[model samples]
Target chain A: MPNRARFIVQIILLFLITLHARPPAAHEAPPSVRAELPLLTAPAISREGYFTLQLQSLPTVPLVVEYSTDPQFTQVTAQYPWFADFSQMTLSGFPNGQHYFRLAQAGVDGSAPNQVGPVVMVRVQHYPLNLAIGLLCFGGAMFGLLVVMIVRGHWSRSRYE
Target chain B: MSEPISYALPTSLGVALIIAFGILWIFYGWYLGRKNQTHDDFALAGRQVGLALAMATAMATWVTSNTTLVAPQLAYQLGIWGMVGYSFAALGLILFAPLAARIKQLMPMGYTSGDFIRLRFGRAAWWPFIVISLIYALGWLVSLGMAGGILLQALTGLDYHIGMSVILFICVGYTLFGGLRAVIATDFIQTVVIIIGVVVTAWFLIDKVSLASIHQNLSDNHPKLLDLLFPAALMFLFNNIFFGLGEIFHSNVWWSRAQAFRKGIAFKAFLIGGLLWLPIPIVTGFIALAAPQLGIYPPSADMIGPMVTAQVLGKVGAVIVLVVVFSALASSLDSLLAATSDLITRDIYCQFFNPEANDQQLIRWNRLCLIGLGVFTWLLCLPQVATLAALLHFTGAFVASTIFPIVLGLYHPKLSGRTATLAMIAGSTLGLISYFVVGFYVAALTSSVVSMLVCVLGLRWSTTSFRWQQLQESDGC
Candidate 1:
């Protein structure tokens, strides 16, 4: 059973990698952040590939996130806009590699160029193939039991008649 | 304050729709009431409901707003196990199928579940059973009422108080006119609406966001959600099963339905209802998984399902979600109102207040009970004390304690009244302590285990062999 489980895990991982294979797309953060609001800490990376960006900014000022693979930062890989009570943003969809993220705010009415914050580096992890297989096995067993119960119930009813 | 989220429907339109549906349902109930010649007819639908309506009402009442709203919230909070765990709740209905058959054979003339408790265990057990039943029923009612208001406000930006009041008024009005017959009949239509609306929303969601993408996204970002070995989620899986069993086994809601369904139909109807309901939480829970991918973050997790549907499908989806939620809420609110009122009328009023009360007086009292319960529920909902899930589970400690007593009492005659009473009190007290100390996830689990142990002890020592024939006694008799 363990051998079969290992094979299943390998197959799922291969399937996921193939499905997620995509042409290189630009992922970058917008340039510049208003200096008044400073980022409290660098974006923290979780085991799950989510990048949590925490900043000390006024609620009124909308924040934008910029990411880039290039250290010179000429090309932007991804951009996300954040607007809500919490000065925190959780970003996903970054491929498994080291990437740079920075917070920025576009000046109102283009009055000033984009204000940029300090850049932070984070790394995304490999897919959780083992967890996926375990979840599927559990779900499959449950549904299988349900089907058996239904058939048995109906079967018993017919015989009693 | 930040502006409330936008919705497709106008507030006036939503209000008008509720009022219109309310008036129509009440009139329909009055029409059905014309056939209600006796109190039994009113309360049990003359115990002649056929296969189709029986199955529909059973499935619809069990759906509740929880199936639509909380299933998604659970999925969002607990991951894959959350939804799969929720779908297991259908086991309650499936398991109850045979029990329903037994209930009908034992008490053909029974009025409520209280009747069974009183006959089996005497007054000592009956009192705590009533308190537990009342608390569970009222908790469910207030939660359903609050869900309606929250749904309308979420979808159409309507005032919470107005939306909440309107739903209560509508359910109370119809139930006041028709009783169980009305509740069942409305449940049939509501079931169709709920099924069609949810299927449509789910279909559109799948088309907009493929399951592959949803799977890959969760696997990528929210790996814990897909983690089968998640500790909290594992605890919730068993706790929810116990809670569902306790709710169905002990509450008058399912008891009344069992009594109302035609003789042979009760078992099959519940079986079929459980089957029909098994897939719903899966469909609903899938929507919440798409929430993170869609970049839609609701202020409250309970609101994720509706918020996601609206943002993805736009205005038309919002309308479908509103109608679906409305139907689900009404189906449950109306059933709780009808069943709980029957308990009050038969157990409290007829048994204690006036033993000489005739069928006409009892029927009138049932209608009045519905209105009074509705008002009380509305007032409780006004405070918005807790989230729907929290409020429902708070009573979990109380209801979960009844599982062992009820199952043992139904099957094993050796279970004594003293043992049953002590089990409930000890189980509930300890369960509440666990809920405060450990967490909500283990409240039902601990309560069920404690209750089971006490019941087994009673079974060992007690020598009484209860005669099933005694269950035929009328309350006043």
Candidate 2:
């Protein structure tokens, strides 16, 4: 009877170890745990290369964000470690293109796995260069005219004063 | 996250510093207040400010929270053009030098820019002008208040509300006690602190990180920042210039300065002030370009300046940033409080409610108005609406519209009051439309163009010639 009880206890302990030993998968997480995964949201379009990425909630663990050209994130272009406990991050200096991003839990050694959240897309479209140049010329002309007006006005007014 | 970003300075230290500065400034204000014997002395520093004080006040006021905070923000957001574009704001002071001379000559007794608009144009123009001035003043006050909160919170983790209220209270206390006299005297001291702090911080940043590495990192990561022909930045350049011009041309802040300086001092002081102020934004701005290399990403763009400084220099950096930002905030906040109150007291209260008010009565009204303005500004700043740059640029539409009208009214005799009124209205309407329709980069430009067109047409068609003598109201109307 004692041998039988020990066998049962060992089986239970083995079962618990097996359950806890499996590596955590972001998608395979239980429904309740998955529901707490942080969501990443970004503007649909960015006129400038820079745009802000907002997380739905504060990250409880260290997180790194990976970006790719494709939604599947097959080939990660870059990874940025979210340094602080901030819900929002302003990323700048991207060349114009469509980018896909996803958040993942960073391991103790800085390896990012257990990807969380849905993939987000941001399309970067810069303003037309010609329009910018045209505005610049127009502005320069106006500025010059203003300078002349002020200098002349000052000079002319000074003689009388 | 790696240890949750900790502030370099503790909250207790920040609170203690604020208390110390607050007491010192309030005491100094009381000391200066003893000399204010009349309304003019309270409102315009007796119109006796010498060149040294005049230059220092002008430079210090221009080196506002905008310079310390928004300049770096723009550089971070808009790249090379941002700092360069912001430095263009000095042109406002430079151009206003001539206008300052003209202003001093035209209305020797002028108390506010609204006074000039009312006497130069009629009631029609005065209404819109006053509305624009008040809105800009309030916007500036709220921005300054917001900057103070942001500065303290970024460095010391202080509550935003507490930091903001302390700054506003300190500024209002000083301006209320000593009026323009206290504002100017404090401004001189603040200017010294700001210059020394900013230079030291920049010097340390350069020592810690080589410019080549910063340049290389930006080139690799943020290539657009290096692009000379960046679209949004290009558009922002001209828009910012006009915004600065509008801000200086129409604001009671600059007008009161013009009125305060001694007769021979106005032009030179502004000129010297502008030249001195020209390079400050560049110094403040370049530090932000180094942010990414240091792996410091501010949750908000406006905090980048102080964050970068703190990240590089640690606790000492925090102390320097706090003191410099406090000085920058106080210099401009006190000036705005004193100037705006003068506008309300003289233009609105005296003109509308009681023209028969004596010097003592006017002084009392000005102090009350100062408190009211401070309270109203605090209420507005509580919500912390929009980024500092956005809040500042929104007023560009309203103020930019006044540029041509003010210029024409001062120089061109053919521009009548009705035409000037139409110009301001049309300019402001179109500018606001553009602000919503296109982007912030076009608002001021659109306003300036439209207003100039209206003024040109007015000059061509109008036969009315305004006599400059009408501005010299003996009863201080």
lDDT for each candidate structure = 0.77, 0.86
Instruction: Report the poorest 10 consecutive residues by lDDT, candidate 2 chain B.
Output: B1-10
Error of model 2, residue B314, in angstroms: 0.5
> What does candidate 1's lDDT look like per residue over B1-477, in tens digits?
112123556665666677667768878988998899999899999999999999999899999988988898788777788889999899889888877887887788787889889889999899999999999999999989989987876666666776887788778878888889999999999999999998999889988988888788678655667777655567677778878878998989999999998888899999999999999999988898897677554545677788789878987888788888888998999899999999999899988999899999999898899889998999999988877777888888999898778766766667888999999999899989988986777687778778877987888888888886788876592
The residue pairs found clashing in candidate 2 are none
Best by DockQ: 2
Listed for every candidate in order, the interface RMSD values in angstroms are: 15.2, 11.3
| Model 1 TM-score, 2 decimals | 0.79
Error of 2 at B87 (Å): 0.6
* Candidate 2 lDDT, B145-209, residue by residue in tens: 99998888777766677788878887998898999999999999999999999999989999999
Model 2: CA > 4 A from native:
A1-37, A109-115, B1-4, B475-477
Candidate 2 displacement at residue B373 in angstroms: 0.7
